[model samples]
Target: MSTVQAAIGLGSNLGDPISQLQAALQRLQAHDAISLTATSSFYRSAPQGDAEQPDYVNACALIETTLAPHALLAALQAIERDLGKIKRGHWQAREIDLDLLLYGDAVIQSDDLTVPHPWLHKRDFVLVPLAEIAPDWMVPGKGSVSEMLAQLPDHFIQERL
Candidate 1:
């Protein structure tokens, strides 16, 4: 089977946030169809969309996977479920949030999934960590990761861990 490089955005603001992220990464690394390549440094940043919640621990990961795009997404969701992700609502706090940020340079638009994550260009939380590991990776229609990061204004302060 062939493998494609992919990027995953990781965040948690509920439970032991940093530990939750570490557990999620361990699960991803254990998946037979996936092999982790690189992971960005974890960051503590204020929540987006909602301010009432606790700050989040955020990071980005690169992987090599033989699973197809949707399957890879399913795998990520499974890890979230395994780690007790409680999705109260969008942007609300959770045990963990695993986003499939990119799958190689493929551009996909579907009811269930979007590659180069629809919000990838707008969210500096993901962009900072994403750029750390994939600064040169192009986002299909948008520009490179570093270019996007350079264009986005810093909103919340990100403290490196």
Candidate 2:
């Protein structure tokens, strides 16, 4: 199968948030269809949509995968479930959260997913970590992630852990 480069967003707010992210990385590394390429420094960010939950540990990962976009997404969701993710509501508290940020340079907009994540530009939590690992990566509609990140107002403070 042909290989595709994909970006994944990782965040956790429940339990040991940092530990959950590290374990999630391990699981992704162990997957046969996915090869973990690079990871950004872990960042701690305030909850965006749901302010009541605990603060979150956020990071970005670059992966080389043989699975198609939707299939890859399904695998990510399964990983989340394995890590004790219970989807209660949007942006609710959770043990872990995984999102398929970008799939190579592919532009996709389906009922279930959107490539280059719809809110990528708006969230410093996503851009900061993403820039750490892939400053040069073009974000399809947007320019370079690093450049865009530089221009956005620093809403949430992020610290490497």
Candidate 3:
């Protein structure tokens, strides 16, 4: 199968977040259908929804993969499950969170997933790390990653890894 470029967002707030992210990256690299390429510097950001929860460590990864979009999503989800992710609640703290941020330039909408990550433009945690690795890549309906990062308010502070 032909390989396609894709980006994945990784976040963790529970336990040792940095270690969780590092192990997750290793898992991605171990997958036969996925070739882990570039990874952005890890960023520590305040949790978005519930201020009471712990801050999250975030990063983005660029990969070359032979898996299709849904398949890729499934693989990411599996990685989360293996890493002890438990869905406590929406925007709640978790062991690991993996999001399929983009699949090449393909636009997709379905019951299970959305490409360009639906909220990539609004979340600095995702955008900052993404822009670090792929500043020029466009987000389909949105503009470039750097452009989207420019439009958002500077409320979210992210410390580089």
Candidate 4:
């Protein structure tokens, strides 16, 4: 099967977040159908919702994969499960969170997943790391990654890896 470029957002707020993200990257590398490509520097961001939770470590990854969008999402969810992710509640703390941020500019909305992440434009955690690796990539109906980052407020601070 032909490979398609895709982007994934990784976040964690529990259980040594940096280590969790690193191990998750390793798992993605181990997958035969997914070729791990560019990865952004890890960033520490304040939790968006549920301020009671610990701050999250975030990063974005670029990959080339033979798996289709839903298949890729399933693989990522499986990885999260293996890493001990438990859905406590919406925006609540978790072991790890994996989001299929984009799929080669393809727009999709399904019961299970949404491409461009639906909230990509509003979340600095996703945009900052994404711009680090793919500043020029367009976000379908929105704008270029860099452009979107520019549109947001400058208060967002992300520590470099």
Candidate 5:
């Protein structure tokens, strides 16, 4: 199978988030279908919703994968589930969250997935770390990663780890 360069956003806010992300990275590196390329330093950020929740540990990863989009999403979901992620609701605190931020510049919309994640532009947690590793990556209808990072609102709370 041919490989396509892909990007992923990783975040966690519950149950030793830093370790969870580190373990996720290790699992991805061990996956036969995925090649770990670049990874950004972890960042601590305030939760976007439900201000009552603890801050999140966020980062982005660049990979080369042979898995089809849906298959890749399934792989990510599997990893999340293995790491004890519970789907309580959108933006809810979880042990781990893995998002397929971009998939070889493909724009896909379906009942199960969306590439170039719908809110990729609006979240600094993802963009800031993405810029560190893949600043030149072009978002399908949007600008380069760094350029998009420059355009986002400055209200988010982010601290590198």
Candidate 6:
């Protein structure tokens, strides 16, 4: 299998989020089909919705994988499940969250997923770490990750850990 570069955004707001994220990273690094190449420092940010919920620990990872986009997504979803993540509703608090921010330059639109995550540009939690490892990565319909970070609205507070 050939290697493909992919990016993933991770966040958690419930129950020892920092530990959860750290463990998730370890599991990611352990995967035989995936090589975690780079990672940004953890960022603390407020919940985008459910403002009363706990703040989240967020970060992004750059990975090299032999799996296809959907296959990679499946792998991520499985990891989340292992960490007790549930998709109860949009923006709900969870033990761990993993999103496929990008898959090479592949443009994919499917009922279950979207490459270059739909809201990545608007979320500082996503863009900040993304910029760390992939400042030059281009969002298919947008510009560079660094440029997008510069233009997003000032709503979220991202502090590096």
Give all TM-scores, in the order shown.
0.97, 0.96, 0.97, 0.96, 0.98, 0.96
| Stretches of candidate 3 exceeding 4 Å from the true structure | none
Return the lDDT, model 6, position 103.
Answer: 93
Q: Indicate the residue-level lDDT of 79 in model 5.
A: 96
Residue pairs whose backbone atoms clash in candidate 3? none
Predicted candidate 1 versus true structure: per-residue lDDT over 32-146, tens digit per residue:
9999999999999998888999999999999999999999999999999899887799889999999999999899999999887999998889999999999999889999999
Q: What CA RMSD would you report for each candidate?
A: 0.9, 1.1, 0.9, 1.1, 0.8, 1.0
lDDT of 4 by residue, 1-161 (tens): 89999999999999999999999999999999999999999999888668888889999999999999999999999999999999998889989999999999799988988897998998899999999999999989998999999999744545776
Which candidate leads the pack in lDDT?
A: 3
lDDT of 6 by residue, 30-118 (tens): 99899999999899998987888999999999999999999999999999999889787898888999999999988899998898789
lDDT of each: 0.92, 0.91, 0.94, 0.92, 0.93, 0.91
**Where is model 2 poorest over a 10-residue stretch in terms of lDDT?**
152-161
lDDT of 3 at 87: 90
lDDT of 3 by residue, 1-161 (tens): 89999999999999999999999999999999999999999999999788999989999999999999999999999999999999998899999999999999999999999998998999999999999999999889999999999999854655887
lDDT, candidate 2, at 136: 93
In lDDT terms, how accurate is model 4? 0.92
Clashes of each: 0, 0, 0, 0, 0, 0
| Model 4 alpha-carbon drift over 4 Å, by segment | none
CA shift at 64, candidate 2, in angstroms? 0.3
